[model samples]
Target: MKKNNSPFGIGGNKSTVSRREFLSKSFKATMATGIAMSGFPTILPASVFGKNAPSNRINIAAIGAGRISRGHDMPGVWQYDYAQLMAVCDLDSLRAEDGKKLINDYYTKRDGKPFDGVKAYTDYRELLQSKDIDAVLISTPDHTHAIIGVAAARAGKHIYMQKPASLTIKEGRIISDVVQKSGVKFQIGSQQRSSEQFRYAAELVRNGRIGELKTVYVGLPGDPSGGKKEEMPIPKNLNYDMWLAGTPEVYYTEERVHPQVGYGRPGWLRCEQFGAGMITGWGAHHIDSAHWGMGMERSGPVEVWCDKVDFATGGLWDVHGIFTTAAVYANGVKMIVSNEFQNGIKFEGTGGWIFVSRGDYQATSSDPTKPGPQAKKLDASNPKILQSVIGIKEFHFEISKEHHGNWLEAIRDNKSPIAPVEEAHRACSACLVHHIAMKLKRKLYWDPKKEEFKNDDEANKMLSRPQRNGYQVK
Candidate 1:
């Protein structure tokens, strides 16, 4: 891990009112004092009065300065004037520096001067120790998400984390519990929740536009079956041990981690040890949408099984390929997850069917698959369903066109965001259960309330894994 000489970056000074407490108490004192003395100025200092006051802005730190952080998370938060980019952290020193430069350059261009306040760190713990940071955007690999999330919650920092909330079911529960106890606002990066087409489809199902909501067809891309197995020297700037986190120690290779040259899609996305392939990678997004439509966002399937699975063998990349997993929720909604569908979610019910997708929108061009030529961004069996407007008395979900903005607003108001921590855990747990069922090649019963496999010790044992190298959750 990269060493830190000081918790506060460069010449930065710590504030007495930490960012964590600022949200809950900052405005209260000012309002209370103003009410008590009608003619007197508020308790807030003069510097905090302006619209762009530093005290009013949230100090956000980027935990993983990789592709998602640069391309999605940082850009999503920094563009808002209420949020400030304070620090960047990554296991790779090169990526950390790159992230710092990215944030600093943006401010320099905006202000028309050399602005260089963003700090770069190779260790996230040191960044968390600083009182200057109020919140964090975690875009780390799947293996490290739970550990970092648990740590960030304990440090009293609000979190906006990437999808596939945890590498294991047990880790998901642990992080969700910690975040609930911390009372810090948390949001999972399931951006589809903020999209119009997805929300409309989900609202349609919730309001009975699709009668009964019988089934959901979720399509996800699959990773290739091969990767170079030859071990390579660890790059000088990358900290391989820290990068591995709680996962098992393995030889360093460019194919095993990320490209040292650029921020292309990383190999770890296809590796089972790091992530459960596209099952959780893309499944997290589509499955979450399915749950939202079914009104089962906080619940999960009662059973899961997959008879058709192809686990890649004899290669560094061993995640599943071209598989189909069927999950039945307690509400009798059967969700079919497969790569054969057109890379989206389709809701089938008694009255009609509705489909929603990004429609040629790929977060990254390096993603393995795209929507077929016939795929549509939003569609329904009947034209009237697509044009129906939701009434105020009818079932309505939260409206958010901006995912990051919703998270920041929730932090400021101490309210739930569009995707809360518990819902994120449920979505990830469903994907993980599907993965386990695929591995065991059997039908497994699940108890959504208890969050475990029913009378299946062999399957339950796979819920959690051993942590090593000083990286462990709880």
Candidate 2:
């Protein structure tokens, strides 16, 4: 079958194959044969659904059961025939139970029988000790990512973690180093790498279709300035202390954590104590894509600074408001990240420009950030540029159709996923440095190789925050 033309260099020529189609065929072939192409894991009887052998399926445990987990992460893995969600853990008892029901209900309805094999726990430590779990899905807040990821790696289970890989640069490096040494398959939730438009945009630039890559523009939304500061009674179902992690202990407030009633967007996302606002929230996605296209996935900028930054005062939320951060790479490539541009990424070079955005693609509809124009998913200075074919001899990226599926495949094949630990750490480190520069309100020289600020003691101190008594990344 002839493929339709994709404006992002996916399909225009008859000889080209869409990455999605290629991956789909590969999956189908693997399922039909029930054989590991890498020749590991003894083949057993087929799965109950006949997708793959039961022994070949990966048993997954979800570590966070709140908004992102309930909405995106769990759904991404549960439906896959080669993956089974065996357990769920959360600091909140209510959320843990909710996750249990969510998984059991799906399996029960599909299997035409009661399925209650999914277990729920309030403590992640207990869940991690389970021998039945082969992997873990961590959709927790930004603050606890490194610690949980480190523990999960030591547990000898594969990891699929949500990005901004860590809350601090030091934490990111620590977790990445541990994961690499543990030799476990790790995939960060930088889903854009798996998207066709984003990958094609990177390909076009890397292949010199855009001439010399000069500057990349990444647009991310900022959280509004409103969160109640008044102390509220802690909910009985929540283990507030555990949720605090290494952050300073403070009175429980709805705005300081997640909603007690439903799985809406959590307020912690807007708090600086928990995250660096959208700079790391949506910035992780767009900036990581920016790095992929700029060929800086393993390396980062030589310098970073913010031209303007606004912080919300007199509220529980203190993350950056309207902001613009700039970075300069060793190769002289410049990157501008701000809330002003339409929500997406734009690559400009001497030859022309290419712009790629999610175009109404939100992980959850609850996300306030909306694409300015739906028609601009992919565009270039010349329409012919999008039609250019990337030859086999030229640089071609590893294709990934679905983020979670790629992780599972990596675990099976013992190979690196689309977004590996080192790349995720590097991309996140860029955002962290940008955040620090915004806070310092000055241009800071960075030593990417040493992963530290160059000859600046004041700025170097912010690389890692002090973790409270029990929550340190061990």
RMSD, model 1, all Cα superposed? 7.8
Model 1 Cα shift for residue 89 (angstroms):
0.7
Determine the backbone clash count of candidate 2. 0
lDDT of 2 by residue, 1-474 (tens): 112133222322334443333554676677656656566665545343354645557889999998899889999998787789999999999999989999999999988999999999999898888877889999999999999999999998899999989999999999999999987889999999889999889989988998999999998876889889899999999999999999999999997899988888899999988889988998889889998888888888899999999999988889999999899999999999999877899999999999998887778769776535563789999999999998867777777788898888777655567888999999899999999999999999999999999989999999998889989986
Candidate 1 wrong stretches, greater than 4 Å: 1-48, 371-374
lDDT of 1 by residue, 241-358 (tens): 9999999999998989999888998999989899999989999999999998988888899999996999899988999988998989988989999997788999999999999998
Query: Any idea how many clashes model 1 has?
Result: 0
Instruction: Report lDDT (Cα) of residue 448, candidate 2.
Output: 92
Pick the lDDT winner. 1
